[model samples]
Target chain A: MRYVLFLYAAIAFVVLAAGSIILPDWAMFLFAMALAKGLVCLGIVAMMRGGVVSFGQGLYYCIGAYTATLAANMWGLSDIFLLTLLSSAVCLIVGVIFGPMLATYRGIFFAMLTLALSMVLYGTLSKMSVLGGSDGLNIAPPTFLGWAPEGRDLQTALYIYVVAIVVIAGTLMRIYFDSEQGLITLATRDNELRVEYLGASVRKVMAYNYIFAAVLGGLGGTIAVLALGHVDPEFAFWTTSGEFVFVAILAGYMSVPAVFVAAIILEVVRSFSNLYFPNTWQLSLGIFLLIVIVTLPNGLGSLLSRRKGGKT
Target chain B: MSAGVLEVRDVQKTFGAVTAAKDISVSVPKGAIYSLIGSNGAGKTTFVNMVTGYIKPDSGEINFGSRNIAGLAPRLITRLGIHRSFQIAQLCNELTVEENMLLAGAIHHDERPSFFRHAHSAAARERAMATLERFHIAEHRNRLIPELSGGVKKLLDIAMAMAGETQVMLLDEPTSGVAADEKFPIMDLVIEALRAEGVTVIFVEHDMDIVTRYSERVLAFYDGQIIADDTPDEVLLDEKVQRYVTGGPA
Candidate 1:
């Protein structure tokens, strides 16, 4: 465990330094966007343990971004660090209220409920002019304690994502997923009847996991919103939730770090395909997902583990 | 506190027009290896489920030790010292044997079963390992549940339940449908382990040798209520229990 932490810390340091010095504006933005998406996928994997595919992640994600957006626009709460804290709190609170109803259902019913919730948010936000409606609202360049991160355009975003990555979110969640509560999540997925018999509460475990996922999702949403310097209701659509699920599936539901790799591959592939054949990027993505699902039943990390264990 | 580990009053449970368990009353004393024997659908499991708090009784009062825990959630009841193993092997098929045992211990140590305030620390691991050793499955700890044989799966399920800080254990057919050769070993291990913990064992089984061998007393169920509840010898020798078993009491 100590060795893995050391290795991850070393890697984070290298990436952080490189982003500030050698990386171009586009690369930095891509890196930050990938990291933000990676955090959202972390929440998805947390839910995935229960065999629940929540399509309402975008609803919570949008709530986080919009909370920050509203804070800045209507309330003039302009400090980025404080806004980040407030955004995460709001998302978690909303998840707390919605969790019991949303988590009580599983399989397709769960999926549809989340989708409906996200769509409702999208509809309501699109009609609200205070949120700037479809045109969206722009955020001013954020000051962290009045000292803006010394980076241009996308570089600043990459720095923010790097902060999110190192903020103990991943480490804390790693411990969580290894706990007995984590086992309850998996047990509930496997057999709710047996887990109950084994002295577990399926509803409580599901609710806790849902709320944790919302916190992570909101954190991701806050980072993403801050990165783009804008917020809009469309960001919280069911389609966006679909995209996060897609990333999680492609990454597999085991390790949190793998999500970043999956996110980067997604961005690189989508952009490359769009540049060459803009009309067929969606088709290419579909084919890629199908291939990954078929060839790697455990996801790409399985391949990495196989190689490491010398079992391939 | 009551001398009985579990004191069940006249419990009633119904499924619409169908009465699953009716006026079922039984008191399990401390340190008794009690077995419930009955044909399928005889309310053996329903009684177990109700006592364990999986299903709420329509009307009943259950006293575990001193506290009335009729409608408490399974986790809360478990903490108050009741554990259970299911008929259909409750081990997580995806995780390893050791992982499953550790998870069982983790509920008491880390996380509130609330999944918050995780107590997943080094101290928890030591206790989890000790529970694994008690079941003699420590050697096969790394193997996943699906890969294990039926007997090993049964062992894992028992170990998982034993991991909880329980004073009473309700095992629903601990050796049900396993190979005849493997049945005794599994039962002996589970009963012995739970006994070591000073936990009262109440299990439902159809096998008569098992009932007579490990159980000090037996509770016979007929049609949704306990008809003959006494020692294995007493219940087996009773005319009413014999009639029900010989297909005359229907």
Candidate 2:
């Protein structure tokens, strides 16, 4: 049954890659950006499974973008794969440093601490004149294993690359959620005392989850920077983190695929509202969120889960 | 006495002005079933908490086997072979009964839980099912905790606690919320299961009937101290136990 899910994911990946050839350049870029942001939301979903909602995920997101951009600019490393690897490694180390401390907190304290950390990053980045300061830095177009695709080809290459990464990440996350450690996390969410009495360390579980979320956030930032061609302090800003939280809540933690789907829906709504309403796009998004929350309290994932007549 | 499996010596615990445990000490013989009887705030739960590492005694030596387990974290104590159940059944309300048992089995059986191994692997499922069957709750294995009857929840809670390698099992009011008719049946099932595994059973109770029926020995508590420690019949006849604990004729 698990392998069957992976097979379906592979098929979806192939279709998305093949179908990208017919999409216009602008549409491809938009979708790539949406998927990149979806990766960040995936990190939030991982932590959510352990009963934590990080409000400062943008801290890792911004760090990843800056890591990739700085490595490319200073070291002249232009390969997308190498840049992503570097960003993930850096984020992993940072996560180790912070995860233990963050793991000690829960509920509003955890939320506020994460938010504070991201805001600190935003503030620090804004004052650093060497790394473009408040205006941020622009990244050079990426090459794929020495093959530099140009014009519309570049957009398609990036779209396909993002699609591949999402498939791999999503599949691994699904497996993780089914693992023994994963079930322990879900148990911790329900009764931490019982989990402790059962001889599993709740703190250790929470710490490991925090580290995983950080790596996912970093991966998302790397992809976003590659597609957007820009990295700025705003990536670590409160509003940026808020948007990721919005996607997480909208997707629900039950399904991995629902996360990206929710992200795409948000992007589409934002794009259309920006184009048509121009000034009231935020209000439009607010109303859309209200509708989703009222109609589906468990988020879009519950709709499919309910049809199957089982909890995921 | 057969070698004591759990030995508590001069344990002291004070919560602000109230003395919860004052120089209390007891040695539980291996494989013996002991019942603790006390009124509310009489420090019955406090003693359990101290032994299980939920509340560290102000000063004491809690020796389980050869190790002093006092002041240790609950998880560490649990891993060291002392497991416990709550007065109110502690269970994952969102997960099914089998899943809860599977989680406990996975954690206890493996040196450490695997990140990639499926939680409901064939081996884990088999173990979970066996434990459930032993407790006579196999029929409700797929039902969620909230959906189970109070008696079933209590049974499942005790079953989960028994999932690990336990030398000593502390059951805090195991039959508290259970129906009167169901209490004896539940106690019989629990004591039989624990006895079959050679686990030392220490349970707290207000039900004198249950105390006399299931336990070979009884400890009566009053004002944070043990007033009577003897066979069930002898403890029931003590003057202090009569006035302070069971409210029976002295």
Top model by DockQ, which number? 2
Worst 10 residues of 2 chain B by lDDT: B241-250
Model 1, A1-312: lDDT tens per residue? 546755775676566656656767777777777777778778888888777878778987788788888888778886777887998999889889988877788899988888898899899989988778877788766667666654583366446445555436776776676666777787677777667766667887788878988988888888788778888887888778888988988887676667778888898898899999899999999999999999876666666542223111
Docking quality category of candidate 1 according to DockQ thresholds: acceptable
lDDT of 2 at A180: 92
Identify the runs in model 2 with alpha carbons over 4 angstroms from their true place: A306-312
| lDDT of candidates 1 onward, in order | 0.78, 0.91
Clashing pairs in 1: B110-B119
Worst 10 residues of 2 chain A by lDDT: A303-312
lDDT of 2 by residue, B1-250 (tens): 5889999999999999999998898999999999999889998999999999899999989998899999999999999889999999999988899999998997898568988888888988999999999999999987888888889999999999999888899999999889899999999999999999999999999988899999989988888998888999999999889999878863
Error of 2 at A98 (Å): 0.7
Q: Residue B51's C-alpha lDDT in candidate 1?
A: 84
Count of backbone collisions in candidate 2: 0
lDDT of 1 at A280: 92
